[model samples]
Target: MTTLRLGFARGGLEIKQFLRSRESVVFTLFFPLLLLVIFGSVFDAEIAPGVSFTQYFAAGIIAAGLLTTGFQSLAIQIPMEREKGILKRLRGTPMPRTAYFIGKVIMVLAIGAAETVVLVATAAAFYDLPVPSTAAKWVTFGWVSLLGISACTLCGIAFSSLARTGRGAPAIVTPVALVLQFISGVFFQYTSIPEWMRTIASLFPLKWITQGMRSVFLPDSFAAQEVGGGWQLGYVAIALGAWVIIGLALCVFTFRWTDRG
Candidate 1:
């Protein structure tokens, strides 16, 4: 109970810091909106029969917003903190180290939730997006959002160990994330992407997350466009679960408090 309280307080501070940081705000809030509006309006026509491009595209943008917030942002922030001795200083503080990480996870949760709202609201207002209507659909959205954010956040923490300097952080993380975004069909409908490319994407969390979102937002008839012509809910759960485990293990193994080396 005490630890939970401490983590909440620490997380509150992190939220304030996020609000103050222009880069953080823009990426978390603006970038996803930009992508949605630009791509959605331009590709508003149906590339897939019976599925409006906007409807097909909105859900994936929500996942992208969450991924960019938790993965890309943390990848940059963690390495910069280490390089600036922020992590070292925090270690010397009286607070539990776990609280710092909890704080980061909370930051991801807050931003990811906000991003979801923004994407859904924008899509509905501007693009006439179809929302999750059933109780089951909402339930699916809940679990998908939770698991996706957690996996991305943990992966970000693990990948943070890769950057040796503050300047190197973006160079290291952005390309990997951008490549995944391209392959994972964040900016395009997965069905239109090549089968081999989809296979490459299926190996990662982003693809599953986007698929899960599609399962919730798209109509039952829309399943034909999917690789298996179904939601593949079991596969989504398993793939994301595996990534969560792998990410947690990697973070435990590779975490560094300082860049003294």
Candidate 2:
């Protein structure tokens, strides 16, 4: 209980620092909106059969928003903290090393929840999508989004340990995230992509996340393809679970509290 409380305190401070940055605000709030505007306007229904460009793309944008808030943010922040000797200074205190990481996870979870609300509200207003019509769908959305956030946040921490300095962090994280977003159908419909790209995207955690969110908000009849027997529920479980496992293993092996490492 004490540990958790302290973690929350640390996380609150982190959130405040991040929120104060205008660049962080843009990345957290407007970057996804920019993607939404570009893709929503440019690709009309004529581009895809049976799919509304705005509605179908909303899920992916929400997924992207959450991923950026948690994964990309942590990936950049951690190494920057290390480069600035923040982590090293913290280590000199009595604070348990894991507390620092735990605080980061809590901060990311809070940010993810806020981002979800923003994206959902925006989708409802701009895309005319129904809010989750059933309690079951809402529950599914909560579970899947939370799980996805957990997996990605841990993966970010694991990867950040590989970055050498503050400058290297964004260079490494941004391009990778951009590539994944491109291939994961956040910017384009999956059906429009070639078979090889579709298959590759299917393996990415972002794809499962976007598809799972759609399953919660969109009608079942609206699903473009039956993945994992139905709406790819099985695939979501596998992809997220695999990433969580791999992320934990890597963090265990590589995570460092001190910049000197």
lDDT, each prediction: 0.87, 0.80
Residue 1's lDDT in candidate 1: 64
Clashes of 1: 0
Measured over all alpha carbons after superposition, the RMSD of each candidate to the real structure, in angstroms, is 1.2, 1.9
lDDT of 2 by residue, 1-261 (tens): 767777878888888987898998788778887777777677657333444767778888888877897789999989998888898899888887767877898788877888778878887887766789889898889878987888889889998998888889999999978877887767876666777877887766788888888788667876655344367777788889998898889999998877663
In model 2, the number of clashes is: 0
Over all chains combined, what TM-score does candidate 1 have? 0.96
CA RMSD (A), model 2: 1.9
Q: How many angstroms is residue 79 displaced in model 2 relative to the true structure, after the best TM-score fit?
A: 0.5
Query: Model 2 off-target regions past 4 Å?
Result: 46-50, 224-229
Write model 1 residue lDDT over 71-125, tens digit each, in one string.
Answer: 8899999999998899999988888878888889888899899889999999989
C-alpha lDDT of residue 205 in model 2: 75
Instruction: Output the lDDT of residue 111, model 1.
Output: 85
